[model samples]
Target: MTDGDEQVSGPAGGSGAQPADPPVTGLAAPNGGASPRRRGPLWTALALVLALLACGVPGVLLLGLVGDAAGRSAVGRKDDPATAAARRLGVRMTAQLDRQASALLGGDRTGFLAVAESAARPDLTRRYAALRALRVTVWRPVADGAPAAVDGRPGEWRLAVTVDYCFVAPDCTPSTVEIGTRWRLVGEEPRLVAVEESQAKPAGTRPWEVSDLAVAVGERTLVATTPALRAKLPRLLAQAEAAAKVADRYAVSGTPPDRYLVFYAGQAEWQRWYGGGRPKWTAGYAVGVGGGHHDVVLNAQSVSPSGMGELLRHELAHAASLPAEGYSDRSNWWLVEGLAEYAGADGQPVNRHEGLAEVRKLVRGGWDGRFDSLAPADDATDDRVGGAYGVGYLAVRHLVDRYGEQRVLDFFRAVVHEHRSLDDAADQVFGDPWPALHDECVDYLRAIAG
Candidate 1:
């Protein structure tokens, strides 16, 4: 197995090598359309991973907004002429920026041209066209970091804008990105002069930039630049199909809509998408976009041969069960991930067994973490996180082993579709509360591991 840093603590795990932290950002929006709220630990870890890459600082969300610019004036103190001019210009630019955003969302090339300078029209048109082709919609273009008046030119200003990209499907969650923009006064109006879009890909590159090639196997679409890599599509498609079947057996609301787009790339491309070098143990990730589709990327360059299929199944399970709208709470991390591992365990991959063993070692080694709180430990030692996976798998494995797969599946369905807490779901499905079930898992593990 390719084992540089990929192991399971959360999202990514294996044996011998430490598990890489999985990308927490791309899974389907847990909460589809609910009011915005703090995401659970899964997303919190993903944000940390992204921040680690972009700024070499961990714990910040992806491309942290430069800084809140609303209160600070860029030009000078409140009494300065430059400040007044900048304030007026800032208001006008904000309006024009809104118009520009509308044009981009509507795919109105002329509308974009009307707002952009002549020198920028062609590029803007091309960019808008590409975004439209990708089926990306910009919901809001809010100014984030403060706007600054250029030192010597009263006609120039720079603003940091964060645009949220809506999914083509109403059920999918939107992705937000921070971009730095420069606006210049042309003739009587302000127009876009330049955009330092951090999220913008090179020409001809797709959003993931893993590959430009594409193919379809059943409901899955595989994209890559190499024929050899593309050949692997059949295997992934098979795994996805199996994952769906396994997931359906346990599903409550039926399978989610499947975009089924998979991308094959090296570690470099994977890191690029997250905006930084991922944890050395990182291997691959699945990102859920609009339209009930998930874009899966494999670190083709890193995952071991023995692990490739297991990784695919695990991620596919996430794709299969992702809710169309809001998110699951942090307390249910074990349920969300335990089920993924369960669905993917039919192959008898060693990683699962190793993770299970890791938990035993932790218990023997004096660790006291509980399965209920098992999540990706972005900062914890590998052993602790690996134990999380180990114990998580055991918890689900015990439920299925004792309660029969149907009741456990029902439990998952209730938590996801019916929005039941883990305790509620357990009580409803098994007539036992969470504490009892947790105790059962403890007993089962002790009996077997002893």
Candidate 2:
């Protein structure tokens, strides 16, 4: 299935994790982190994260960056002209970004234009003017990169530096974006010349370009859609709030995210924003982005009225549970997906009984792939992918039945937050090895489906 922002891959043959929603590269660059370790007590890290959030660090300390180019005060050793120049250029670029961020956040088109190149300022101004809410932080400023000679200019050089930013809005999360800009020698000091966004625009399409979006902000959701779908906002908001509440219940031990950002558009708009990799059947997806927010994108054209809540909840489950850094181990794809389904399974796309029946049919048809071996539904048939969802849901359901809800939640924390191997985490909760846990899950599915 095609990837959505949160990728609402269908029940089968689609992204099971949304598989994080189909790998559609968007405005934000992917957050980087080490994979969950196979060994070590991961709960130690979980404890620290929880402790930080408990200290009300969610609003202020949302991100911890490694470098700040804009704020660099270091002066290299004497006689180092290149370092001095880089530092000088870095300061100018930082100021430009600060102005850009301030203008975007304040909805001050004129202010934003002051820092932008005249050519792009009009478009930027229009986009910012239409934007409802925006927050920008330059986590890593443009710095330290060396300058290269421009293609045609003899004396002039260009330094291309990537600025890492966290952009949050009413209908967007604190999604990480890497904006590249070239600083060129205009007169004396290096000045901003060209800027490049990571995501390429699909021809003739952008959310801001969609002229008549009706936007509304709920207590825990931000809904934006065309006038045709505007009436559906109230119900969507209610369901999102309910889903957030449910997700919070499971995530009380960790950081409960802030208000979710839901962008409702048709398939075309969805594809454009998602940078085009979504499967045809994908309804929508909610991306668990960094900086304590999630990005929910839904294709209103594809989702049936009854299925919207379930799909949103399914994505919300991912938003609530998955770490901001993203899930690393593909081997636990089933659990990753199953936990989402189990959490959001108020029953619409498919209820427990229906899903079980479907799994039973698949087992009868000789399906043999273990949950651990199931990868994202990149190439598999839809039926094969859907079976993964069913089996995953049942697996999580069995765990919940056996260990209770909190333990199941803790298991996720150990695996995702703590970065422990699935086996190691299962060992902590079940007190036995992972093989035994797998067998029990299989047995549970059989008993329920037999």
Candidate 3:
């Protein structure tokens, strides 16, 4: 998927770990809760991950990352030389990760005591650091070449682990995790070569101060992370749920277990975890990893008239519809994004005054395909941050007036289907490829503004 160019992609701390055995907890970037081993510990690390999953904690990031099969082989045979040698090294790394993750998740306090007390030993003062939780999940493991770098010199390998973590509210937010660690040989056992904490506003340098963020509403997770932002989440989510409920009862039905609302401090923090930045919508987008099941990650930090509800409507639309289509420029860019903008804002357009002002802005800029078609809104500083969201935002407003809602949905359905381009799907929607109606859409938006 394309990076949301206008925004930011903070440094990804530790990324991509073993064949996922979802671990319990971990944190990073914002908080130094997890410093995944940058050195040796292949077999033992992954085995512990597998053990955690087998032990029944759903600790894994759902993004598909594979673990090393060769490493696992050592575990099955007790006498395997590779397994015997790496045990201490592996145990050290796993214990470290386990300590951090457990603390981060606010796991059983007694359990934390038991492990720490049992594991302490002589000579290693590094083992006595105060504990903090790191919410982590393994994607694919990488064998560090620290061992091979000096040509047989003493070395360590790393289990390149991808751990996705967020400030979790006990039961208010839907929890998901995929635990895995990457084992790449380094100079010794897992050692800290790098420790990156996302200090930006998007991800934050520390946990959000949202004590009242979580409130269970008829089985739905809702949170208000801080006093200032806290008041807004309820209204926003309430509106969204109201919309979804309408769809559920009258339009669609039944929400999935994974569906959740995560309230953060601001736009940038949300971006750190899930922002793809702003891509030229026309070229299409890539959602999480190789792009499947996930869509634009949403947070309440980004708001205005273009704030929360409308913002979510737009983003969530991309998510809901992506399953029906693949995010590629080869597909109908117009149908995918335009259709999403259309669907999301359907019953939820910005207030008429704000909406009209937005139309005025788009009309003045003139809908150049260059801006709206391929450039990301974040980069459109000349138009402020509105970018083409305003342009396409209004176009959606117009389509609902012209073709009826089902037709708009039909366009999305076609665009969503694999191997089909927006142009291919055009005939089904407007009875023309995008360029054919491009000018017409521009004119229609301008006329509405006038």
Over 282-307, each residue of candidate 1 has an lDDT whose tens digit, in order, gives 45554433333345556777676667
Residue-by-residue lDDT tens digits, candidate 3, 14-128: 0000011112233222111222344444445545544554566663321221223324444556533233344444445544455545543454444434323222322111212
lDDT agreement with native, every candidate: 0.54, 0.57, 0.37
lDDT digits (tens) for residues 1-450 of candidate 2? 323223344642223553342222223332222222322233343334345545656442212121243223343534233333333444454556555656666666677667655665555555555453323333333433434434455433344444343434334333443345555444443455555444521111335433346666666666677667779878877877777776666552376666666778765577666464666546666554445445677777776776666677777777677665565566666777788777767533334433565577666777663777754455665566666677888888888878988888888888866779878988887787888888888887767667
Off by over 4 Å in 2: 1-8, 11-15, 18-76, 79-87, 130-175, 182-194, 199-214, 226-232, 347-354
Q: Which portions of model 3 miss their true places by more than 4 Å?
A: 1-84, 91-107, 112-158, 162-221, 224-233, 246-257, 267-307, 324-337, 348-355, 358-361, 364-377, 382-387, 397-403, 416-419, 428-435
Against the hidden reference, what TM-scores do the models get?
Answer: 0.59, 0.72, 0.53
Best by lDDT: 2
Question: Which candidate has the top score in TM-score?
Answer: 2
**lDDT against true structure, model 2:** 0.57
Please give the lDDT score for candidate 3: 0.37
Model 1 residue 134 CA deviation in Å: 4.4
lDDT at position 356, candidate 3: 55
